[model samples]
Target: MTFLGVFAWSPVSSATVTTTLGVDPGAWNVWRNRRLTPAPLSRTWFRRASGSPLVYQVSDVLVWLATKRGEHIDPLTTWRLSLARDFGTETSDPVEIRRLAVLYARAVGPVIGGVRFTTAGFQAYLASLLSSS
Candidate 1:
């Protein structure tokens, strides 16, 4: 998903971001500042962690895939599914669990955007991946 950078910004630590998205916060900082291209979509307040240590909200990491991107869903459904697997959330049988994961990921995978992203998806995705592979 693509954000126009108009959403509310929160004060989150890099540890929170890494714990959720499994990516180093430094990469996001570099990419958001335009130093890198086609990196995960994240919106940050500052470019570098010069003065104070950087902080990141879980939403910052999810905005890349959950927000709108051009026309398509940016990372594609397959990518989302793969991400779910990698994160340990399988999209297999058992309609109830799969449905829950889908709903969770669609809502923003283990984080909150406008108070929507939550840990439900995080656990679901992680669980799914573990069972699948």
Candidate 2:
């Protein structure tokens, strides 16, 4: 259930996934949520403002930039850097390749859903992090 740079995780302490979006839309109270759209999964909103979870069906989509190491990933980066291209082309070593694959998944989730990196958002996000470093 992973996307370009996001993990398809269920609510682990109210972790959520969202779609059918527009504006803030008041936390899953929109028609799409009410109807329970099948095409996209819904979950409670991770209230960034309050730093809490709110019950609702929403497209509260999250983009994880991953916090893995030079050769390690915890939970987010594996999804963020997911996909073959997200995987570095260093060596065909199974271990190295697998590590890259995991990193790919961590770095990028279903932000694009099998779609290649065709948006400026991902690149921009990476640039922001690098600049901060």
Candidate 3:
């Protein structure tokens, strides 16, 4: 989904930053396979070391949900599911969980604007989500 327009002014110039947050199906597929595919003998290592699996899985589910519902799922829900899967049952408070999710989306939205995808970017995104609240 598209974000509300943001305005920034400098002494010499000004610019508006508008970010759209959504996964492009083809790009996401390529990124998911390339980044989430574990080494044949190191699946456990990969899962333990990174949140790529959670991100990949949640992205798929979000895509499905969006298609089935015929509307874009907000970033907050996307972040919430990813956080829940990555953290398991450790974080169970609905209010706190949503607050954390919203914080994550706010912190990471600018970094992940547009249609770009990268493993490092995804990891950083997860870091922001995990570190919040």
Candidate 4:
């Protein structure tokens, strides 16, 4: 099952499903944990694996995200999408998608992998995701 030319294991509920690509469960599960966790979602093991602050501008993907608009995301959700944008991936064809993916991952990787998220942080992230615009 797929949609929007993006491959997925099954069709997504239009209002809920954001991701199109079918990713390995291991990573997504980790992502989900962080996404749902409150800010400061566990900071012990992932610290070493963490990288520098996400490079939002370097990737073409980031630029694309700047243009995109969506219902504001809770911080974790916002962070999740951002991370995927930067690090998750893109179909290896068009230059545009690739670029967008990079930017997103950079925005998201820290909270998803590095920081610990709390419920309050989640709300803040969501507030941001849902643009006042």
Off by over 4 Å in 2: 1-22, 36-82, 88-133
Tell me the TM-score of each prediction against the true structure. 0.27, 0.22, 0.27, 0.21
Enumerate clash totals for all models, in the order shown: 18, 29, 0, 32
Which residue runs of candidate 1 sit more than 4 Å off their true CA positions? Answer: 1-10, 35-51, 68-133
lDDT of the candidates, in the order given: 0.40, 0.32, 0.37, 0.31
Candidate 3 vs candidate 4: the TM-score winner is: 3
Worst lDDT window (10 residues) for model 2? 56-65
Model 2 lDDT per residue over 1-133, tens place: 2432332221222223333223244554463467532223222112232444333211123322121113433323332333233334435344443444444433554243322222453443333233221
| Cand. 2 TM to true fold | 0.22
| CA RMSD of each candidate after superposition | 12.3, 13.2, 16.5, 15.9
Per-residue error at 103 for model 1, in Å?
A: 26
